[model samples]
Target: MKALVIDDSRVMRKIVGGILVDAGFEVVEAENGQDALDRMAEHDDIGLCCIDWNMPIMTGFEFVVEVRKHAEWRDVTLMMVTTEGEQDQIVRALAAGAHEYVIKPFTPEVILDKLQFLGLVEIEETV
Candidate 1:
């Protein structure tokens, strides 16, 4: 699977990318929502996008709204991985068309489970 992980923290991005890679996925990085959108626009092979709530250039909510407006990218599974634990923020993200939500301090197991549940990661046979 191919995933685009959008976050402001370099550490967070690397951590998430490592998790995805371990799960047998090719991951791409974006510093912010705008960068994510630009990457998405250029790569149609992207099957999933993991976004962060707060960003400098463009917020994740704004990016979600923008992506939701386009028909082509509607089928992409959008998941938010951030510290925005407020109920209203979760509601807004869901309303804007996010498929899954994962709060910060998440374990790699949590991320893997969500990806599997969302049909983003294909389970491979062990040797």
Candidate 2:
């Protein structure tokens, strides 16, 4: 599967992209919501999106709303990976069509677990 990692922080994008890549996903990095939309236009195979809440051009919430408006992108799973940890913020994102929510400062395992929960990845048991 293909995953888009959207964040204003280049380091954060790299970290998230690397984790997704390690989990067998082809990764694409976007600086913000607008960039993500642009990438999506170019790549119809994007199945997942990891978005940041706060960004310059467009907020993650806006992105979710825009994506949900398009039937063509309905199958794309949206995950918010941001520092906005408030309960209301989480609720808002979910209400806005985000499939999963993960606060910033998360470990790769957290992301992997969420992806597994979303059925975007299969979890393997260790011997």
Candidate 3:
């Protein structure tokens, strides 16, 4: 599956994008929410989005709300990958439309675990 990694920080994008690519996803990246929306318009194969909460032009929360409005994007799963770790923020994101939330400074395993919850991947047992 294709995944969009949206973040204002180039380094964060690289980190998240690398994780998804390692998980077998074709990765496309955008610096912010608006850029991501534009990329999505061009790529119909984007099944997942890893979004950062704070962005210029449009925030990740706004992106979630806006994407949920489009019937064409109904099957796309949104996951917020941000430094905002407050419980209320987590609840708000999920209530808005995010399928999963991962706080920043996360290990790759944390992200893969969330992907499993979203049914995007299955991590094999390691002995």
Worst 10 residues of 2 by lDDT: 118-127
Query: What are the lDDT figures for the candidates, one per model?
Result: 0.91, 0.94, 0.94
Extract clashing residue pairs from model 2: none
Which residue segments of model 3 deviate by more than 4 Å? none
lDDT of 3 at 120: 95
Flag the better candidate by lDDT, 1 or 3: 3
Q: How much is the lDDT of residue 100 in candidate 2? A: 98
Global Cα lDDT for candidate 1:
0.91
Error of 1 at 56 (Å): 0.3
Listed per model in order, the count of residue pairs whose N, CA or C atoms clash below 3 Å is 0, 0, 0
Cand. 3 Cα-lDDT? 0.94
Candidate 1, residue 67: the lDDT equals 91
The candidate 3 region of ten consecutive residues with least summed lDDT is 117-126
Q: For model 2, how does the per-residue alpha-carbon lDDT over 7-76 read when each residue is reduced to its tens digit?
A: 9999999999999999999999898889999999999999999999999999888999999999999999
Instruction: RMSD for all candidates, in order, please.
Output: 2.4, 1.0, 0.9
